[model samples]
Target chain A: MRPSATAYIYIAPAFALLLFVLFSPVIYGFWFTLFRIEYGAPTDFIGLGNYVRLIEDPTLLPTLSRSGVFTAACVVFTIIIAMALAVWINRLPARTAFIVQMVVIVPWIISAVVATLLFRWVFVNDIGVASYIIQLMGFDAVQPLNNPTGAMVLLVAVSVWKRIGYAVLVLLAGLKSIPDDYDEAARIDGANNWQIFRMITLPLLKTPLLLIAIVLTLSTFNTVETPLVMTGGGPGDATRILAMDVYERAFTNYDLGSATALAIIMFAGNILLVMSYVRLARWQA
Target chain B: MSTITLSSAARARATGRHFVPRLSWLWSGLFGCLVILNIAPLIWGILTSFKGQADLFRFPPAFVSFTPTLENYERVFLSGFGGNLGISLVNALAAVVLALVLGLPAAYAFDRFNFPLRRLLFLAVVASIPLSIGAAALLIPNYVYFASLGLTNTPIVLPMLYAAHQLPMAIWVIKGTIEGIPRELDEAATADGCTTFQILRYVILPLVRPALGAAAILVFVGSWNEFVASSVMVDSPSLRTVQPAIYSFIGFFGREWGPLTASATLAILPILIIFALFGRLMVSGLTKGSVKG
Candidate 1:
């Protein structure tokens, strides 16, 4: 075989699987959205009926906004915490920093479901750890998952907890790659810590920050396990982000048409968010 | 006086060899507290799993002085969660194998072949990372499609779906690592009259083993952790993976904190061990894979 033909032969299996398993299913899902399926049958060609439901449905707008709020909060807080952690880690004595870095990685590597379940136990009203801490501090025991705002906060915290390690690691790698001369030179020139960070560090850290922002935004947006396992979209749909919304619609309600339409909208929304971030980053650059 | 200042600055630079500019004890303590907070929940779960059921609800939640019991383990095993554990192991292993088998070659092709539409195809692979939400999105459609073919409730379905979900990352990681290998090696192999397939099988494969290890570890952990699709795809009790099985503990053993947590602990322990064993490679691969593009 010619080299190109040989290359094709080598690549055929993966491409074939990707095509049939991923691409085909996605295209099929998009097509499935245009028709109403009743009782396991495609009962009518409801071209855009389900899509129309996205606009008409009462819960749709609230759910989308909730997802937006959740994603935005999760991304922002995760970046702050992780970046702080990274900056600190960067400062530690070498051996201690390595250990701390490894210690922080446990959460990221553990299963999300397990992490979610663990947090559920940790915040379970009075018996939970957070509440226990609250009681220790002379406060009333609060069920963090009992209200919409509280539940949303808990979900964001859990997602951030799961993801902070990755962001820290990424940012740490970026932080390490910076030559020490920049900071030392600034220090010698009478720049204080904050001034050094603002003038020298932050500007150079933009690439990794953008990468972290994009990845964290996408991961948080696609989050279903945290909400599903922790809140179950509870406190009156306060935490019913789009991923969970899609899962509940298809599985709980068995509304395939509505589910697929919602899924497509979500898919589109995610694409738009990612593209906007890329554009925004580029524009700022 | 200028020479004195310069010498002092040189001495300061030498002493500051490991300097991470302006990190103070207060900042270190704050970071330490955050790290403790980060791992505290998991540690609490582990501690809770070892406690007797009565200790879990004790006022203030017992932090110490409770007899750890084997009863939770007994209860979880009696409830047949062991089989679920076995299924998770098999599913994760199968997913890794499938991901690597499908992903390595694609990575190789992208690295070696100057094919048409290569950038577009690479973008498609990268784009698929976000699109794997299709795993959740196509749950209903996949259900209908598989249900019609009698594939639902089969052990194979979840693994296959997970492999598909993981394949993109596998390809990306492998591609990034393979790209780092010099093209001169490939040219040298061709001069030796090795065919393209021979070169891949002999030369490229050996060079990217660390990446392969990294990709496999990732896919294994990811498949093991997957919950959404596993929950939606399989309805049979015997075929469920550990995540959904853990969810069942909530429903079946409601308020039974001991066995429930014990089960969750068991679910996490294996992955934790795998991660510990491959910590460095996993860290490097994860960072490399995500930051490359």
Candidate 2:
């Protein structure tokens, strides 16, 4: 049925507010990117100059590589660990399983900044318990956020730890969606547990796994807070990812034109990735 | 042939019995390791937060402080730090409310109606992701725009920007939840002579409450931890959120570790409490909204 005029009335306030607050700003971003506008000046049409400048920039390649590496490593770690956790929890009796699951999920809900702060404390040179433990285990020192490689490793580690809970939950949901008859049938056929899981459980879990992978990849690519708070992209830009680079160029250097260019590229890339995932979903359908 | 089959089947059963318990033990061991790794940082932070600065620097570290004082807590809570916490909570809560108000009905419209330019409009809304790349990317134009409107440095600007940034995701999520409610309910309401607003208010609103709560919590947590935009948009010391406050505590040389940790703990408490009470719903809410949307 067609919506009544009153339906239009109900939707009006929301549309008006979104137009002002959300839509206008986004439209203005594209407009600003095309113009050679400083923070406080009349806009001049620059055409594709900003985009050209972005292509010619030296730092973009390394930043992209760093972001890619971060995403790949973090997604791999998150998925594997979350799957293991979900399998373990699935084996438990109901109530205990739920309590343990709740405990695990706590980290996911914690604020990013807070997690960074907590991890920063844990990685501090002398007084940190983690550092102390590592030292006791015969390491000289663990500079988790101080060295570039160390920082990247820690960033991925933190990302995985914070996110594993959600991954576990998602995987559990996927596991529950699978029919027990498949497992029973495999058992009756004298198939081993590994063979049953490999053939049935893994295939059934592909969709959820793909969803988790896509979300994690996007999030890792877009992440700013962990590196921002934990390392400040420190030990001399070793930990600097694309998003931080974009922020530094725009805010620190006040290069609106180039910053917008980078923003557009990043935006395009994310959209493409998401669209690819949608295509995969459609293919499965 | 029968003897061979029976012997192989018995060997297979024996092997399966041995493998199952061993695999179970291995999985449990891995999960236990993860639990330790996950809790390690927070536990360390809590311990360090209680230590004196001198103790913080002591070699081998002091896991158990000989002397623990309320000094750091006092500095954080009584020494003007609480004001920053208060501002963060107020800004985050206000922004969440604004986003929900602006997002819910739009979500309903998208879920229920096929208006002109529907896909295009929805795509426009979903494209807000990149706008959040950094405060800097949008800050220049926003600064100029807000200045022209006489809203720069005002409390309104941060929430407005946050609400705008968060609206798309919120709308998409609520729309997904709204779609999950079958259309027949609305038809029934209409057949009973209820107006659209009456139907939404009486029927849709109550049904979507769980999704609404989930969106509210997510938005609130996002705004509370928001740093880049708030830092750039609001320059006044009193207007800064908790994240920037933590940043400021660490100057060029070194950080005030004790009070910083205390403040960090304080900042995390509200979200933790919310999660503690609504943990399961929150997870399902995130996955449900995110997976579908």
Candidate 3:
């Protein structure tokens, strides 16, 4: 059948609107990097000047590495926990599994600010549950928020806590896609549960695992909300990772050119992840 | 789903001896800890909201023994949280509506017809899902651009941006669903002399009701729980959404736990209610949107 011209009519408006509101600023971001911007006012174009300036900037490298460490911890922990939890959930009766999923997903469904606030209450300096427990243990009560290492640890823990549910949902779906015969056949062939999981299930889980990895990596790298509320990149900037750095520089320092340069770098990384997601997703299908 | 030749009794027995039965104790223990870890915050927050400041600071905490008061609720409402709640509802509803308005027809078009650049167009929709995830990278640029145009602090901009951000996922989900309506249905409708738009409305729409529900949930949750975009897009106190409103309460009530938790609980309850009602569909919607897409 001949395709209708109305197809374009149906699609064009939505895509055009998306290109304008959602995507145009990204193009404008590229443009902003070439200019010195002061509070939304742009000076003359200085090609690659912003990128060059960042090379000598001391804060840039540490922030990048901090974000790297933070992101790595989160991705690793979230994947491991989510993979294990999904496997366990898959073993349950169908009705029970859904209920477990609902309970598991509440944190993820709550706003990031709320999630951070909730955890912060648990560790509040003088009158917190965790602090009370420490005192009860006969070890002088401690304040995790005020300590640098504790702050970083708390940030990563909170992030991983919120993200595990979504990852499990994705992986469980992947687990469901595998034919029951593969594992059942392995069972009949004298394979133990551990061997069957290692050989049949893990191998088949490759695509979803990679998908979850990419998704978590993107979300973790892009997140400023978690750190913004929990620690506000404070305690001598100890937890000031790259996303927060860009946000602080752009909003707090009002250094548009440098923030734009750093953000462009971040945006470049995002594009790579998006490319991988598209390719991997297509391959899965 | 297994392709085994086992009889019904054998299959039932195989199911009974499902993998990792020996690890049942370990699994249950881990699952219990996780469930507690995930839900304790919510339960504690609710408790903290109602406690008097004295009870809030009590040693060893009061789970159910504390005299719960409505003072915090009074404070939250008296301090104009109602406005923020209304704004959050407005923004989320507008986003869901706009995303659906654009997404449904485009999805119908894709499933039924082949057009120029169809594959590329579809890929663009898929790519948008990831773009929304990495949107923080674009925040500064978006803020600057919006500011340059004097569009910052405007009401329409936030919902429109939210809608556009959700558009791709909406289209991806609806496309996956609308594809399942066998073309014979459309052909049958056509044989009865139905027009294109008429068939889409009368025949296709009802068949894909779950898709519509799923897309609505995705867009609603995305917009409702959104803090970063809602914060950056508008600075006016009058335009604050519930998430940012709860966040701003930090500045207002620093170290004052009562109103903070009250506002927090208020922000959480509506979404939780929706989730409680439609959770299974939401979960299926998620996998259907992603795995199928």
Among the numbered candidates, top DockQ falls to: 3
Model 2 TM-score, all chains together: 0.88
Task: Please say which candidate is ahead in TM-score: 1 or 3.
Answer: 3
lDDT of 3 by residue, A35-129 (tens): 87765688888899999998789977888888999999999999999888899899888998888988888888888889889888876546877
| Model 1: residue B246 alpha-carbon error in angstroms | 0.8
**B-chain TM-score, candidate 3:** 0.90
Structural similarity to truth (TM-score) of each candidate: 0.92, 0.88, 0.94
Assess chain B of each prediction and give its TM-score.
0.89, 0.86, 0.90
Specify the poorest-scoring 10-residue window by lDDT in model 1 chain B: B17-26
Query: Residue A245 in model 1: shift from native, Å?
Result: 1.3
User: Model 2: per-residue lDDT, tens digit, A1-285?
Assistant: 354444455457656766665445545666667777576443789887788888888878888898889889999999998887887788788898887888787677676777777776776544677777888999887566666888888878778887888789888878877878889999999887779878989998888899778767776777777778777877787788887777777668878677766766776677666664554332100
| Candidate 3 wrongly placed segments (more than 4 Å) | A283-285, B1-23
Error of 3 at A116 (Å): 1.0
Worst 10 residues of 3 chain B by lDDT: B1-10
Compose the digit string of candidate 3's lDDT tens values, residues B1-293.
34564576677667767644656877789787987788888888888999988898788878799999989999999889999999999999999999999999888887787877788888887888888888888888888778788888989988988898888888888888787788888888889999888888999899989989989998998899998779888989899899888878998999888899999999988889889999988888877666653
Candidate 1 lDDT over B135-217, as tens digits, reads 56555556666665677788789888889888988888898888779888888889999988788899999999999999999
Which structure among the candidates has the greatest TM-score? 3
Instruction: State how far residue A133 of model 1 sits from its true place (Å).
Output: 2.6
Looking at model 3, residue A90 earns an lDDT score of: 91
Task: Sort every candidate by DockQ, greatest first.
Answer: 3, 1, 2
